[model samples]
Target: MSSSPLASATFWLLLMNTTWPSHVHNTAPTPRGCASRARGSPNSSCPRQRRSATSPDQFVPRKAASYYDLLGVKSDASADEIKNAFFDKSKKLHPDSNPSNPELHSQFVELNEAYRVLSKEPSRKEYDLKIQHSYQGRQAFGSTSGHTVYRSTTTNDNVHYWEQFRHAQSPEATAEERKQKKKRNFRLVIYCVITMVLSVGAHAVFFRKLEEVHNSFMDEKDRAITELYNEAKERARANGFKKQTEILRQKHADFQEKPEF
Candidate 1:
């Protein structure tokens, strides 16, 4: 059937309306067409969205040393004795002497630092006092901890009961306790000194370690960023960034005309 000219024109107009992008209905401040389209997605961006804080217990690396144990010296050792002990330990633990054990390398450097402090009269005295103070209030955990107040129910006299756990809890009483404490300190110093030495001498020199800590800290921050970006990108892909921006705009916008919910 031959259609009228006006009817044909109306059919073409409807076709054009279906195919073309219409802006007349756009009340958005950003002309919907103007936003830069997501190009080759970078998979990420800097200045990223913020996140909640993590717990302190989870934040730190390894446990810090008990400084007294680090020095591996008797609480009562004389200044000269401390110096000699440090000198002897340092030679044994120095990284040059032991190449196979990386742990030893770290310990070697740590021990050197501890000995360096212990050999000096002022530092040694201060360190000794500090150790004594750390142990003062707390009961010894075991013979190792210098806290030997044990309760035994077996056949034993009161005197025997008193002796079951050597009263080495008091630093002044047991020379053996002092010896153990000193030994522990030596081990600590050895570890610290070796760590320091290895850190310096390591061939690759973990660049991130330059940030006051070992390379691990930088790695942590990077992983955090990666996680954050991945999360955001997923949200962007699923919901579309334009809708997200609109929701945010409506939340913040204070237009006289009520904004569309």
Candidate 2:
């Protein structure tokens, strides 16, 4: 059957809506780079997403030499050994010996720095403690990497790069360290005194109790012995009195019988 113009238009609109793809309506517009990528173009100037700074691949492992390594001595090397190593290296790296070489001159400067720290007992101990606690210091000194770089900076820089690793203690810092040491020693002495006092007090109480028990036992024994001695003496005296009375009675009987005869 033939329909009216309005009815035909309405039917056509409904058909078009039903036939359209659902994704075309829902999808957002593609970016220019995405469109280029979809076209498989090689010359597209699309920027790639950069890797994160914290990504493992972004980190390049670097090995650095510690002062001990620079001096060619072990970390646990004695003061004498460190001094001797510095002297030996100094002879080779001295500016006068290698006048033309700038590299040796730099090494001589490093050698002097190492000697200045390691030659003294206080600075060396402090450096050792720092290396033990620091991660970079441990990696530098602990690792056996073949390519080890020693960090250096120009003298114009506010602080030398090596100074970051080891620097001379300020007078204030030295005084503070000494103060801490004295405090620790004082605490240790106080602890010892407290322990000694407690021990002596415990011993005195134990000994006093022991003496009281011993005295009580001795007094009881003495009382028992005295009672036994008194009982024995009273029995001996009663027996002697009975014997004398019997003798007197026997003598009187004999005298009466003689007078009657």
Give the count of colliding residue pairs in each prediction: 29, 0
Candidate 1: lDDT over CA atoms? 0.60
Over 1-261, each residue of candidate 2 has an lDDT whose tens digit, in order, gives 889999999999998878667897787664575644734356655544467879998788755567898889998898668767866776787678967887775666666677777767898899778666675754767745344445466762224334523543233444676798999999999999999999999999999999999999999999999999998678767769777577678988887889553
Off by over 4 Å in 1: 1-72, 140-261
Q: What is the C-alpha local distance difference test score of each model?
A: 0.60, 0.72
Residues 75-138 of candidate 1 have per-residue lDDT tens digits of 6677656555655665677567878876665565455555555655797678667667656644
Weakest 10 consecutive residues of candidate 1 by summed lDDT: 164-173
Candidate 2, lDDT over the whole model: 0.72
| Model 2, runs deviating above 4 Å | 1-169, 241-261
Point to the candidate with the largest TM-score. 2
What does the lDDT read for residue 200 in candidate 1? 79
